[model samples]
Target: MDPAGGCPHAVNARLRTRGAVAPVVLPGEVEGAVVLGHEALKDFLAHPDVAKDPRHFTALHEGRIAEGWPLRTFATVRGMTTADGADHRRLRSLVSRAFTTRRVAELRPDVEALTDRLLDGLEGAAAAGRGVADLRRHFAMPLPMGVIGELLGVDAEYRDRLHHLSSRVVATDLGPEEVLAANRELPALLGTIAAAKAAHPGDDLIGALIAAREEDGDRLAPEELIGTLVLMIVAGHETTLNLITNAVRALCAHRDQLALVRDGRAGWADVVEETLRWDAPVSYFPFRYPVRDLTVGGAVVRRGTPVLAGYSAAGRDPAAHGPDADRFDVTRSARPEAARHLSLGHGAHYCLGAPLARLEATVALERLFARFPELDIAVPEHALAPHAGFVGNSVRDLPVRLHP
Candidate 1:
């Protein structure tokens, strides 16, 4: 069946036209390839043969490390992103308790309060000038930093520095020397935070991790602790920042849906979900290598083959999402089974912070609309600055007019 041209496919076509290469899909599939590389993408994500080590993908590895960014230390082994099997389980187990539904719900009040504060700052900025502001700077960027900073025990004073370090590290265009610098310096920074959390334990995630390390004994190494903390701070902030920006951009592009959300006729949560599906912040995850030879979709995947799963492509598959899959309709009730948008990922490597991400987006969107009832784009949509590369995609700046 032919797609009516919406969401993922529409975006995928743009990417393809811009020189992004993907596997060729068969006739029946909506995308170029249903079984990208060797097997179905979902199967590859579930396969134990497929490992998350970026080292297997030589080009990506060299490209990221070529730069001397200090945050690379955390990226190389920090958190659950690189871990597989028992190590993945151990790291996930340690932090799993902190991201529970109850915890996310408990944090809603704080999220709302933080959202309000951010809007207050944006309002002040806009009022002082032309009643216009860059949503990325004033709203999207800082909200996640504030929320995740408090969550990870990063000192309030150092949030800006951490944000700078994180941005440089994950930046796709960085050279090897720049990436290496970030990889090296991140540990010392995180080490200082770990010490502070150790000395004066707080009710934050870092403090909890330190306690867990001390009580468990050998459960988590010092490097692992630094890595996990870095992961939480960096990943938590960058991804959420993009998610907020993408959501706003999508709503603005679809005026009717934006009006629906603004008028309170549609559920904000559903709108957020659709936004994630429509223009996900993290477009594609890095390749996972196979530990052994495997056959997928009649193709042979040799050992150590790198497989890149297309989240952007999968979410927009017309076969899975119906003809209007690409349309941003807040009233559209997404099926749980069909909602398997690769945005949060799949299988064992699924995102640990999904619940928290949803909570933040829901709170942020509701507060944003409620505050700036007359918010609209200040610049032409095509003029928006977008961060390019395979790791993450987001608007660099979102200039918008806010009417009180």
Candidate 2:
């Protein structure tokens, strides 16, 4: 695949060779940057020289590069995604207070309860002789959103609107105007929530962020607060949904692996990790630009290059996971940290909601299979639809026969 061919974000895992740093084209680049993956992935993700935050781009401010095509579509705001170094540390530190070890532990009972409740609904649908249920919508979709909403202090009335914005923003198929319109509404909604939280503090993540103070007595600016909340809501809701959705599909697709877990031979943790490794939740997230010119993986990535991580393909790097890297095997042992999946990302930008996502997926998958017991895929393998965009690794729906 020519790096100069299309939107680098749309570069599918199937088209690019694993662990190979190929020169790929971004929308505006005359000469595209080297796309890093496979053997080059671990180092590149951990490299301190490369910055993830787009706000610090030297080329953008200096007008060295044209910012029309990709820049217009994605108006990245100032938040953790746009922060680096001290700013990142401070913002992440404040946010970390909301996801404390004790807080996460406290969430277990609620998560388990939510899982059982959703499963009960599924069981009820099966008992009523409906036979078929859209587990993607019924089970995988709602659980994470509900949990994250409660955690963030977002009201129930706002959930439907949030879902729509998330879908639109991640979609690669949306036209320019449609993309702008979606981006426009997202912050307005988050701002409304932020304002309410400010007026009436609640015992929730948003409130925690608002009240959190740094060692130097700094607070998250108003816009930063909204950006933080938006990040938490989107990542907390969507990625976890995909994680559960992908896991269910993977287990159903590989019945032998399902039997191992359902019959008690293997643990649910094995299924979650294996699924994260095999089918990543978010395929390719965003571009991380080089602060300056740097050579990576036998190629020169010039200064200000917009380089996105090939996250979905990194997990299957043959150098790390052996020749069977692409195969789904629940019994596989955990790989070394360096060679592990970049599904949830790596380094400072590594996903903060990872623990919650894992907990949600595990609890949901466990209760789901246990309650239904004989749940079977109602649709053909090809009938299931992958997410339309390159951003998320998800199916349109997972139709199942609960009583089968």
* Segments of candidate 2 deviating more than 4 angstroms: 1-15, 26-36, 56-75, 123-129, 334-339
lDDT of 1 by residue, 1-404 (tens): 11111233455765443222344321122122223221256676897777776555443454633234322342366568778887788888888887889988998899988898889999888887678888888888888898888878788898887877777766545556766777667667888878978899999888888877523465577878888877887778889898998888887778789887668788889887787776777665555666676776446655554455666665665656677766777776645545456678788978888999898988998889777767888889778756744446677788888873
lDDT of candidates 1 onward, in order: 0.70, 0.74
TM-score of each: 0.85, 0.89
Highest lDDT model number? 2
lDDT of model 1, residue 114 = 87
Count of clashes in candidate 2? 4
Candidate 1: lDDT of 223?
A: 76
